[model samples]
Target: MKKTLAVALALALTATACGSSDEQDDKSEFAENGTFVYAIPADPGELDPANAVLGATNTVLAFAYDTLVYSDADGKIVSGLAEKWEAQADKVTFTLRKGVTCADKSPVTPQTVADSMNYLSDPKNKAALLGVLIPAGMTATADEAAGTVTLATKDPNPFLLESMTAVYVVCGEGLKDRSILKDKTSGTGMYPLFTSVANDHYAFKARADYAWGPGGAKHEAGMPAAVQLKVVKDESTAANMMTTGELNGAQFTGADRKRVEAIPGVRKGSAPDGIGEFFFHQGDGRAAAENKVRGALVRALDLNELRAIASGGDPVPATRLISLAPDPCRGDSVTGNTPPADPGTAATLLDETGWKAGTDGVRTKGGEKLKLRVAYQTSAGPGVQAGMEYIAQKWKALGVETELVGSADAKYADSLFKDGDWDMAWVPLGLSLPTQLVGYLSGPGPDEQGSNFAHIRNPGYEQLTAEAAKKVGASGCEQWTNAEAALVENVDVVPVLRPTQLVASKNAMLEVIGGVVRPTSVRMLKN
Candidate 1:
């Protein structure tokens, strides 16, 4: 009787296993053997990971391209194509993993990696990270036989490894022809671009032979075969699509955040939001060039009230630019550096600066009314614009007249670089490390082809950053912190909210890995 009962139990277990397998197979028939869906707010027409500036484009490119180094969930540097690396005082060498191939099945030799480095190193190429991620004076050489790429640096780059994590490697074909990449990305990533429908969707086919994942991660068998990105601008529309079982995942921000979270099946995926604030123009000619007025501008707004509206939730006051996990030089740099918001003080400062309030309550100096043009970016959405309007109102209340302008992105860039018509503008600058801020800190003005948008030329801040650049790792954290302090103390930058990353998933189908979505993390789970 005991032996018969045991046999019955064994049969039951086998039947359960078979039933589970059948269920997965049935689901696979839906969309290209299970498609991982990503809902985007705006259409990132075509992904170009190498020069990605916006957060939306970077998310799409993350799956389509593989960087030289990987930062794990903890933001710890891990291996990618370069399986192993050695960093010395003057040089850093990486050993390219063997058998790695680009999306076109072309061998990713050491020479290919070296060629990518040489391409970006050229100033003419106008790579976004010209002086930021990629160090200024560096030459890359490859030994195909040894499967190694060597970078000999002219200056000591403390955050060299961290900066390298942002650079995605491309094969020679894509390197020579950038137009090919502009339409479709051909990279050493797991997914290759299959089709892109303008403003609709971007479909990708997974490479079964993919081997190189972050930290030597292997492509699991049950991973999604195809991933599709559906661009839905309206947050409510995206939430509706998720509830209707169309998309696997979506990111909802600002006012639409609560509505998306209310849906029963949606799961919230959170990551530390990037720090954002208005950086004052410090160029010699601008009205904001005066340190006192810049300080007054920051003080005029009611930040506590503004935070409630500007940010989706209770605003998390930003302490640093990159607050993501395992972030080097972690501390409260924003707290002490930022001055308390005082409207009364703002009025007094303007008065002290020879700009006295007239009968109309608008401050005036000499023959000119103290009027400032404030440009808010269109990409920040309606919520940020609403908040900026309130801040402008408060500025008006504080005696200074403000001309609020809703400038489109390209036009705003022109204002900073070409037109030079504005006194103040809102720009969201984000980076994973303090070292990356160096290029923006001390460089030629925007018109001069440098990232100094405000054309700030600060000798003291420049000196501090230059000294910080020489030391490696945590050794230079204090110097970097002090440099940021110099900017904040002088009111060059107004540190505001650290907006949280909001990723909403349908039926918990997809997950955010290492603060962003990746191909390896997507899987066909039982609903």
Candidate 2:
């Protein structure tokens, strides 16, 4: 049996289930070949898998790259580039499948895969997936004759194999010159980049000989000969395209969901993306740097109302940070862990902390005013924008001066990692394993080339997670749950709601694994 992790990011807000339509049961035949067109929210910057972070970039990369292993919708590890794999606490070995070739027609060798891993593990390379997928300081070795690549880490990782499912393998050519990947493909996926028009659209040509897909899936009858992704920023516009047959599939998470659900003959389904979390920056001089102020600010907002507003309806209240399916640790660490909604208590806490209300109704501590710059991703849809605005309104009522800053994915990343201008941010750090979150939650800040943007220093969380990492797989679930509870209890971060992402499709039958359209699972229907 193989261990799995739910680490897929929701790409372009859409994914299709195994059974995309009720009519598929009745109809056994479909079109032989056609183009499958879909919509993405923004331009996928830097096609190199190592540097790709934006969900849109991942969506495009999904069609052009393959991982060492494949994680199904059910969170099961299956064969991908590797025919088989063995994972232990400190190391993992992958056996390459025969006849695998890169988009450039070069045969994929074990050394090529090892070089990709080695590149990501090196800090000097500055790959975005450095610690997220390939652990920092990890090393890889390849045996050409045996056709195997083994990855070893000094620190033990129970979920090491699960994390490998997210690393996109780059071929030798792309590794030498990454600029080629910016506008093209250099991987061993079913589709290769054929044409790219930046923010407008991207087209990929299907490889007829490609056979190694998730769980041995292959190109079959009715599979799209080509795939095209159009940049459609507006949900209503994307939904309209889906209805008019301009788009084969699209995802809606906001008010446009109702419109997509009403379109007849469109196959629809839902998946758990991740929790919409509020992370307070603990950097010096920030208002939220004070623990009492953080608690008071959280208490001022009605979480129930905010969840409804953010999700566009009643959503499942997030129980833990891992909202994706098949969560190894099934426990509610968020409930009864956060501060309750009590404006009076919030005001009292602020008053006790020297944040007294002034003549302008804004709280002031010493001589400085209580001000916060709240940030969010504008591309997260209108619900998120409204949710940020709602927080600002609630904070204003609590006499805390607030400024809401919303930007696209690239700009948002720059704000959190480069500029460091935000006091609090409504960012969703989605991951399948608790161990994978250690760097983002505790390690060095962005200034030190680490992802701990919040700069959280919860000693209890670090201690608990360290103990949990020593154990293997599910045995450490209890400590992991307790660690998350400690973070919530300390008001270091707030888990709000887990939104059910809705996807709809027309004239196409396909399956989405790990929030990406499995290239071989797509089957075109006759118009």
Which prediction has the highest lDDT against the true structure?
2
Best by TM-score: 2
TM-scores of all candidate predictions against the true structure: 0.85, 0.86
lDDT of 1 by residue, 262-364 (tens): 7765666555555557777777756688888888888887676777667756587877654533356775667877767888888778788888889998888
User: Lowest-scoring 10 consecutive residues by lDDT in candidate 2?
Assistant: 1-10
The Cα RMSD of model 2 versus the native structure comes to 4.6
Q: Which residue pairs collide, candidate 1?
A: none
Q: Which stretches of candidate 2 lie over 4 Å from their true place?
A: 1-28, 103-105, 172-179, 285-287, 323-330, 354-369, 407-415, 418-420, 446-450
Q: Which stretches of candidate 1 lie over 4 Å from their true place?
A: 1-33, 46-57, 123-132, 172-179, 323-327, 447-450, 508-516
| lDDT (tens digit, per residue) of candidate 2 on 1-527 | 00001122222234322223233463746787699998887788778888765667877998989988877766677888999998888898999999998888888999999998998889887777766667768999999999999999998987777777777999958977877876777898899889989889999999988988877878888889899999998888998898888999876777788889889888877666677889999987787888998999999999999998888784669898775423567679999999999999999999999999999999898899999999988867778888988999999999998889998866777788888999999877667667767777887888877778888989999999999998776778899999999999999989998877666778887665555566777788876
Whole-model Cα lDDT of every candidate shown, in order: 0.69, 0.80
Score candidate 2 by lDDT.
Answer: 0.80
